[model samples]
Target: MNTNPFKFGTVVDDEFFTNRKEEIGKIHSILSSENHLILISPRRYGKTSLISKAIKALERPYIFLDLQLITNIEDFTSQLLQKTLKYYPFEKIKHFFKSFRIIPNISLNPLSNEVDFSFNPTMSSSVILEDALNLIEKLSTKEKKIVVIFDEFQEINKIDKNLDKKLRAILQHHKMVNYVMLGSQESLMKEIFEKKKSPFYHFGYLMQLDKIPYEEFFDFLTERFEKIKNNGSGLSKEILEFTKLHPYYTQQLAFNVWENLIKNNSEDIKEVILNSVITHDNDYERLWGLLNKTEMKIIIALAYERKSPLTDEIRTKYMLGASSTVFSSLKKLIQNGFVVKINSSYEIEDPFFKEWLLMRRAN
Candidate 1:
């Protein structure tokens, strides 16, 4: 069987990745100039992939850290130390330990051939954080330029109330390091970067990633599938429209369609969509159960509405209560990743979830 070209739920490299030329260029330019950047986008919109691609093209020494797995301040410090050591050379590592005034306890694991580093139990979180920041600063001085990316950077807010404040204080002075803070949680990311009261207010250039352009996506799909069969342009366009050109879902739906085409060579798009929905039925059902009644009602209303939900007529037709209630529910939905506000209109972020809601309402 041929390998599925479409990639979902992970960082896709060159072959699986489609167009983001403009995004890559902008990020490169920002980092090359020694400027920090904050990348904001909804879940599954390819922010991680874009970061990975840009890092490869940068051809510079860098470290990529995913803050999603970091639960506390200690984890943040340990991860920073570990990832930095992993990316830098052994001579640089020795230099870093000697140059920093305060060093974390380091140990070597004999069986796994891995080094473990952590702060002393007697030290406070603030002290450990200071040591980690100092290490980064010293390391940056050794290299000409270094890039560090903290994926899901918003998680730091949950780790500690003052973590962002502490980070901003140290990171603002680094002369040779470029920081890329990436987050899928739009509201929290904005709170950190956009709000004037926040510690990272205007900390870096803010870039919001949107869906891939339809023409670029369609061409990529056609070229990939055309090798198997000559006539895939129509089907490629159909898939793009159906998925609304969402990066993750478009790839997921195409994976299913490609499988079906391999088996029968005559697969219908609608049937493939149904199969895809069925495959994700349990996940969709569990997602539905997580929402409150008001959220559920609003999502169902959006699934059926042909116009913007912000209109008074649509609000009345859906019996969506007062403007305040609607706004509150919308906020909750957005924070939980169920909805996204695009310019003047709110949309169900997941197209499959919207279809699933429509099916539930019909029954």
Candidate 2:
């Protein structure tokens, strides 16, 4: 493959991915102990990419499943079954799912390589999702110590309000398994796992993933870009500094600006990458429109003022309501996975968005 610049969506392995050594070690420690962990960060902080890197380092067998594509409970069941069966011959795992006798007519076509399990639970258990839990329980009994990592865990609450409760019970019963729940929405992930009232509370280690440091990222890109084009094209120290230190934005801006430079066949080295962000204000306006009144206020407030613990005085100054209202909305923003809270203070999660917020303020 022709090597270009490091794109925003590229998931670099342990060797290529720099910084966050301590965070990676923390996640490794959890999985190593066969314990569960909940990874919380707002969107674009590279939650999926980083966790994929972490899982790759694991010595144990692991399966990474994204919940975004799986909407209904039945889809969840079928996908899990398909992934599990994909590793082994259909004949071997066919009997594994046989006992879900509700799907009494289950069969695996050797030629098509499809496992067809036809059984619906009685009306009560069907809607209650007990049958789905039972199916997971049956799968858990296998010899493999399943590392069930659920990405976008916040979506579960939307699909089923009582999903955490149901899954917690089933997961608790399966001792041979470990879970790493990765969520970009810090607010929702926290509400799901940090709140005392939440069933998933204390189910796993509440680990917050912060952005990679600017200096480290600079050094990383310096080395990578040099490898790709030697002295013909490169990023400068000053330009890198102005782009902000957030991971998601840094990657996106760097990728965009880098592509701009490459496509133009010019490496002035002093080109203003901030122009990409400035000229692209419309892109962010659509995003701004998507936010609710409270969210918009918080974003605007944080753009100009970011204080730790987000006091009631600050909330009032921003024309926001009581502290609780701000807190609740902030939590929702965080859980929605597009923002992150730094030591109890909040900021837009994506590097590009943060930079965009700052650009809007300047305008």
Taking every candidate in turn, the Cα RMSD to the unseen true structure, in Å, is: 1.7, 4.1
Error of 2 at 29 (Å): 3.4
For candidate 2, the lDDT comes to: 0.67
Clashing pairs in 1: none
Cα lDDT tens digits, model 2, 1-363, are 434555565666654467577888887788767579888876666778878877776645565678877766665665565565655556665565455534444577799767754445542333334444454445554355557778888888665566677778777766666788988766667778889998888897888877787668878777766654665224735445555566655666556556666577655533545666567779878888789988888877776775732677677788888778887887777655556677665666655566678766777
Error at 91, model 2, angstroms: 0.6
Global CA lDDT computed for model 1: 0.84
Give the per-residue Cα lDDT of candidate 1 at 340: 84
> Candidate 1 lDDT, tens digit per residue, 176-213?
78899999989899998989999999988999999899
TM-score of each: 0.95, 0.79
Off by over 4 Å in 1: 90-92, 98-101, 141-143
- Residue 83 lDDT, candidate 1, scale 0-100: 75
Q: How close is candidate 2 to the true structure, as a TM-score?
A: 0.79
**Model 2 ranges off by over 4 Å:** 14-16, 104-112, 116-144, 228-240, 265-275, 291-297, 306-329, 332-339, 354-363
